[model samples]
Target: MVRLEKDLLGEREVPATVYYGIHTMRALENFPLTEYKVSPVLIKAIALIKKTAAEVNFELGYLTKEKGQAIAQAADEILNGQWQDQFVVDALQGGAGTSTNMNVNEVLANRAIELLGGQKGNYSLVHPLNDVNMHQSTNDVYPTALRIAAIWLLKPLSEGCAALQEALQAKEAAFAGVIKVGRTEMQDAVPIMLGQEFSAYAGAIARDRWRLHKVEERLRQAALGGTAIGTGINANKKYIFMVNDRVRQYAGIGLARAENMIDVIQNADVFVEVSGLLKALAVNLGKISHDLRLLSSGPRAGLRELRLPERQAGSSIMPGKVNPIIPEAVNQTAFHIMASDMAITMAAQSGQLELNAFMPLIAHHLLGSLKILTNAVHILDEFCVQGLTADEEHCRNLLENSQVSVTALVPHIGYDLASKVARRASEENITIRAAALALAVLPAEKLDAILDPRAMTRPGIAGTPK
Candidate 1:
């Protein structure tokens, strides 16, 4: 069945059963970009804003008690996960998310009217703009809702980071005693405990989680009372003062009103700052993944100091081949996140005058990066970091063969003799210990004690070289 709905652009027949109205219908027609619909979390954030506005308006005697009650009930239903499919507009629409804000207002209005025993589109009794959107503009409400949605979304990403950090720390403890040759510029530089490398990864993830948690401080300050352009034109002074408090109560988040509404409305630097933190996380994850790939490069020919879990058959034609698919997937996810950060940077800079017209793109990229990184962190923990196994024998062998092990003998035999020992090891293709003993650089017992890889990983002057 079809019902006619009119707007300034004219009337269109919308599906009778849908809660969304003509504004949403026009947006659907205008932005046929993809099958991507608005985020359900974003929709719920908008509904919470609408419900709070209704309560404030009713308390100020601008709305009837019955109208406000019905609107609040309808918003509660939306928050409890109903009528999600009725939000049909694309997420990437233009006009700074007016289409999205209007979509929420219309849906809440129609549903509230139905609850009040009136048919949908009966705006005379329970109007979408007149009652539900009282004192609200897309400029104020949309950015406010986006902030709430981002705070809501960051919880999962923070949890994912914590999980990944725990997994890496477990690996760190598991490999604490295994000594390996540490490389600089692809050459052996010194001996180090394998645990130290994993500890570094864990530290990076811990910092990322801390940054994610700190970001809420900036996101909590919103431009909700700014009306159309921070002037609070048509809204009541009481409503402006009380709305954010009510919103914080309804949403159960620490949302604060912006002290300077004009600056909040005109600038998107907070989002840029948040995206920069996300990019730093992506860079860390990418570096960790790359290091994992190199550490697990080969079983026979490359630096196979660690064994990654064999996830699947790695080749279409070759047999008995297992690849580091999990780390590879994480690498790709980080790349996507970095690119999304670039998009967010451009969108933030595109703001002009009183408001940014590029909010839809900003919303799309920011939320998308968060979602992907959350999943990436979870999979990296489950498929890669948790199941890592260090090749202890390989680590010992590499440490023994490394010419850089002569670095330990520098204090006893002097750097000049240590340099000659290293040169002889490389020239004669022998172990550093063998070259030192052949050159009589130190006594055999003294050389063994000084060149001990495990002792080298720690402190204390190599036991005075026996």
Candidate 2:
């Protein structure tokens, strides 16, 4: 069965059982863009905002005790994951999330009415705009909700990064004694411990974790009470003070009201800053994945220093082929994250005077990026990083064959003589040790001690034979 609901734009037939009413119905007709609905995290954030507003308005006597209690209870139910499907608006809607705000308001109002022994859409008993929304505006509530949602999403992303870091650190410890030839510009450069390479990956992820925490700190400052234009117009002063406190209590996060509400409302640079950090993390993950792909390139033809876990078949026709699918998947996720950052940047900069009309887009991309990145990091840790194995013999063979091992002899034989040794090794297609021996640069025992790949990976210059 359907019920008729009306507004200034006229009436529309909505399904009678839906908690959302006419406004959401109009939005559903309006923005038929992506099939993607608004994030449940965001919906919960908005519910918390509404719940907090109800509690605050009730405390200040702006709402009748019964109505406020009912509204708060309805919002709490939504927060606890009830009737999420009633929020039917597209994630990409216009009107600066007014559609989203209205969706939340309508759902809460109807649910509240139900609790009070009235039918849904009976706005006469408990209005969506009057009782449920109370003193809130989309301008303030929407952005505040976005901030809360971002913080909620970032916590897991941060934990995912830390877990990935720990996995890399474990690899670092496992590979500590494995010496390998390090490369620069895709050419062998010097000897380095395989552990050092993994350690650097761990350090990069550690920094990403730290940066995400910093971004969370900025996101925790919200603009909830600055209704419409940051002046808290049409809202009670006491309501403004107590609303954020109540929201903080409900969210269990360290959310505070923005000091300069106008700045928070007008500028979306905080999200831009967050996108930048996420992009940085994407770049780091991409680089690490690329290195993994290169190091684990081939079992027979390429730099087979590391063996990635064989997760799947590489080709349809090949009988026994396994590709580095995990790292490649991470690389693609990084690409999407970087592109989302660009979208977020454009949306953030496109904000006009007092309020950004592009908040829906911002919220969509920001939360989307965080969610994808968190999943990507977890996949990379579990599928790739944790299962990686170093080819100890391959590493030793590469170190033995590389002319760059002459780099360790530089201080002992002087730069000029080391250059001769490197040139002669390349010319004769011989190992640096063989070239040094043919040139009679040092006795065999001395050459053996000096050209040790393990010793070369450690600190301090080569000491003269004692």
Candidate 3:
């Protein structure tokens, strides 16, 4: 079944059973880029805006009550997850998301026509542009919807970060007494408790979670009511003033209309700022994952100080080989997020005057980064960080073998003597403590006092490391 629809360009045939109409049909034929569809969260955000606009227009006497009710109902159905497959426009499209906006507009209009006992493509009954998309433009509506969708995704990412932080903090507490050698530039440097190392991860994740929440405030400013080029062209002043508040009320979000709508619509720096924060998170997660991989390298030959949960086999032919698969997965996810940040940065920088034509690119990378980072954090918490076990005996053996722990006595025995002891131990194939004893650098009791894990892991080493 085909229905005839006409636009300024000409006429096209649309499937009669589909809610989406001619604009979407044209877009489907035009854009055959990435197969990814528009994000459902973004679609829902647009529906929230449409429903709010309909109710506001009806109450303001711009729309007839029946058409308004029918349009609102259609939007509500979309909001409730109906007709999702009808939004067939490629996420990567031209016209600065006009195709996506028109896609939504057409679907809602056709569905509303059905509700009002009119057939699809009956513009006289419920016009897609005249009634459903009244007082909105792709310039204003797309960016506003992007912000709402970004905020909604950010909440879960923040929560996922919080969960990761808590998991790391738990490890910090669990391993507070587990002694280990710290490294700098991939070389053993000094003594540190496992807890202190985990504490650093916890601190970084805590900051990431807080930053995600703070960045949400930046996304709260919406370009809605700004219309085409931010001058609210062809839209009534009453609608311009009332629409944002209604959107906020209906969406239960703290979205506020920008004071300088023109500037807001023109500038794409907000996405760059948000992407920078997400990149920061990626950096930290990458660092932590790298550390996990290093520490859990081998049960027999590698550092073997920290043990990750037994997951999959490391090789197809290897026997009883358990790899740090979860952290490896997290590392890949962080890498992708970092690359996404770069893409988002470039797209944001490429914005021209009046509007950014690269928003689809930014939206794809930004939203994708948010979702993948959230999943990475959650998996790191549940699958890796929580199941981590410290190889205390292995840690102790490494600490005993490395001369780095000798640096703890530099305050009393001096650096020159410590170096001599380290060299003597290396040359003689003996422990630093034994070399120190043979050199008579200090009494055995005094050497043991400084070498104690508690004393070695703290500042101003001495009794109880206070």
Candidate 4:
């Protein structure tokens, strides 16, 4: 069935079976930029806003009890996962997210009209503009809904960081005694416990978790009541206060109206800040993943100091080969998030006065980064970190052969003597331990104590009294 709905442009045919009306139809025609729709998370958040707006309007006598009840009911159904398919506008639309807000308004207005025993598109009963979207503008509503969606996702991202931190800590404990050769600039440096490396990763994640927690405070101040340009034009001041409070109550988040509503509307610095935080997390994750892949490079020709779980075959042609698929996946996710941060940075600054038209771009990349970062943390924890093992004997062998291990005796002997021992070891093609013994740099017992894993890893000069 086809129904005609009128807009400023003229009347257009809308699919009668679907709740979305003329505005949405026009958006679909005008902005077919991508296959992606506005995130369902943002849609659900908008439903909360509309439901609260209706109840407040009814309380303030701006809407008839029946109209308000109908609108609220439609919004309730939407919040509970109804009519998701009716939100048909692409996420990449122009007009500063007006397409999204109008798409939502038209859907609820049509659904409410149906509830009131009126046919869909019969706006005379519950007009999308006059009733369902009473005193609201896309400039205010879209940004507010985006903030709420980001708030919802940030909590899980924080929790994901925490879980990953715990997994790294567990590895720290499990590998505390296993000494490995540390590398600097891709060259062997000195002895370090495998556990210490894991501990550093845990520390970085802990910082990321704290950062995610703190960034939410910036998002808590909203511009909900500041309709169009933050002047609250066409909206009752009392309704503004009431609606903002009610939305906060329904969301169960500590949201407050911005003291300078125009500032929130005009400046998108908070999202840039938040995106930067996410990028920091991505960098750390990328570094850790690359380190793991490098450490687990090969069972024969590579470092082979750490063992990652065998996932799929490394090569279709190579026989009996396994790959570090989990870390590789995490590395890609990190790269995408880093690029998203850059996109978010550009969009944030590209806005002009009064409002940012690039908000849809900001929302797309910011929300995508949050979701993928959270998933990456979880995958790294469950699939890679949990199953990781260290090749202690191989690590020990590498340390024994590495010339840098001779540096452990530098404080006891001297840098000059240490260099001589390293040079002699290289010339003779013998292990550092053998060269040290052959050179009689120190007593065997003393040299052994100096290079002990505990003495090397802990604070203090090895083979020397405190």
lDDT of 2 by residue, 328-379 (tens): 9999999999999999999999999999999999999999999999999999
lDDT of each: 0.90, 0.91, 0.89, 0.90
Give the 10-residue window scoring lowest on summed lDDT in candidate 2.
457-466
> Each model's TM-score, in the order given?
0.95, 0.96, 0.97, 0.97
Query: Any residue pairs clashing in model 1, and if so which?
Result: none
Q: How many residue pairs clash (N, CA or C atoms closer than 3 angstroms) in each of the candidate models, in the order given?
A: 0, 0, 0, 0
Give the poorly placed runs of model 4, Cα more than 4 Å off.
none
Q: Candidate 2, clashing residue pairs?
A: none
Clashes of 1: 0
Overlapping backbone residue pairs in candidate 4 total 0
Candidates 2 and 4 compared: the better one by TM-score is 4
**Tens digits of lDDT, candidate 1, 1-466:** 9899888988999888888899999999899996788888888999999999998899999999999999999999999999898888998989999999998889999999999899898888788888988998999998888899899889999999999999999999999999999989988898999999999999999999999999988999877778999989998888988999889888888988889998888789898999999999999999999999999998789899999988999999888888899999999999999998999999999999999999988888888888889999999999989989999999888877777678888888899988998899889999988998899977898877887777877777884733
Write one digit per residue (lDDT tens) for candidate 4, span 315-429. Answer: 8998999988999999999999999899889998999999999999999998888999999999999989999999999988887777767878888789999999989989999
lDDT of model number 1: 0.90
For model 3, the stretches where C-alpha displacement exceeds 4 angstroms are 463-466
- Over all chains combined, what TM-score does candidate 3 have? 0.97
